[model samples]
Target: MITAKNPVHAALFLVLAFFSAGGIWMLLHAEFLAIALVMVYVGAVMVLFLFVVMMLDINLERIRQGFWSYLPIGALIGILMLAEMVVVLGSRYFGLEHVPQPAEFPAGYSNTKELGRLLYTDYVYPFELASIVLLVAMIAAVALTLRKRKSVKALDPAKQIAVKRDDRVRIVSMDAEKK
Candidate 1:
């Protein structure tokens, strides 16, 4: 996975890495999270990514035009983020004095159950808000994609429903010929 050189290889490697992490989570007794991660990231996200890559007409040259100008700033930001993460993770910086230690784990403890308890009891409001936000984002994406083109004769249900029967079916008086 780490041997990826190009963007496509990197994406594939990332998907593989997520799957591996999910497997690790499963082994650690977080089956719910493990399955969720695999299903969401591997099944949905990776497939969506593949579709986007395959379908999109990407303008590489346009993107690369200002790459050199942006590189320094991007690299600086990345370095700062790495430093912040290191500080947060390092005991020497954010030590025992700053935060409480994790509770001792009982033998045969289920990580998934613990996570569920914490999620419902402690973080339910945040969880609900996150879901609502995601729903809104999905709706927004659908609205954005649904552009009404003047060229196409698209039917509006409201307009169709409002139409009178007389307007649709016109009765014509014609002389019947003897056959």
Candidate 2:
């Protein structure tokens, strides 16, 4: 997805990746996360992303021209990330011996219930902070895109309110003509 040349193709590939990750999460018994990944990320977010990508008037040639120049730096970052992942996954702290097994839950126990409890009780502040950040981002996006262009004709409420009856209606005396 990252390597996809076309932005739309990249978005589609990302959707595929989300679906795959959701499947992996389902396999790991994280049903809430898996469903949220598929429904929120894949269904809603990806659709909006694809719409934005398609609507954008992008110069593909210009974008591709810089790819070769930035390749080395991108490769370096990718390699570093992969190395970090390997180190974390292969470290002794995360090894089978060091990792504690999950406690056995009764059939009535719901992971979703536990997740909701943790989210609302333990991690409420961080979750609310994240929501605030998202709200600010949304407002910022709107403010940034809302430009006052001279070409666009807009009504002024003050001017409209100040108008009198004569300003809108013109009366002229004329001789009546018979047709």
**TM-score of structure candidate 1:** 0.62
lDDT digits (tens) for residues 69-129 of candidate 2? 9989999999999999888878888654553234655667777998999999999999999
Candidate 2 residues lying further than 4 Å off, grouped into runs, are 95-103, 143-179
What residue pairs are clashing in model 1?
Answer: none
How high is the CA lDDT of each candidate model?
Answer: 0.80, 0.89
lDDT of 2 at 99: 35
For residue 139, model 2's alpha carbon misses the true position, in angstroms, by: 3.6
**lDDT tens digits, residue span 48-76, model 1:** 88778667776657756787888889899
What are the TM-scores, per candidate, against the unseen true structure?
0.62, 0.71
Q: List the residue pairs that clash in candidate 2.
A: none
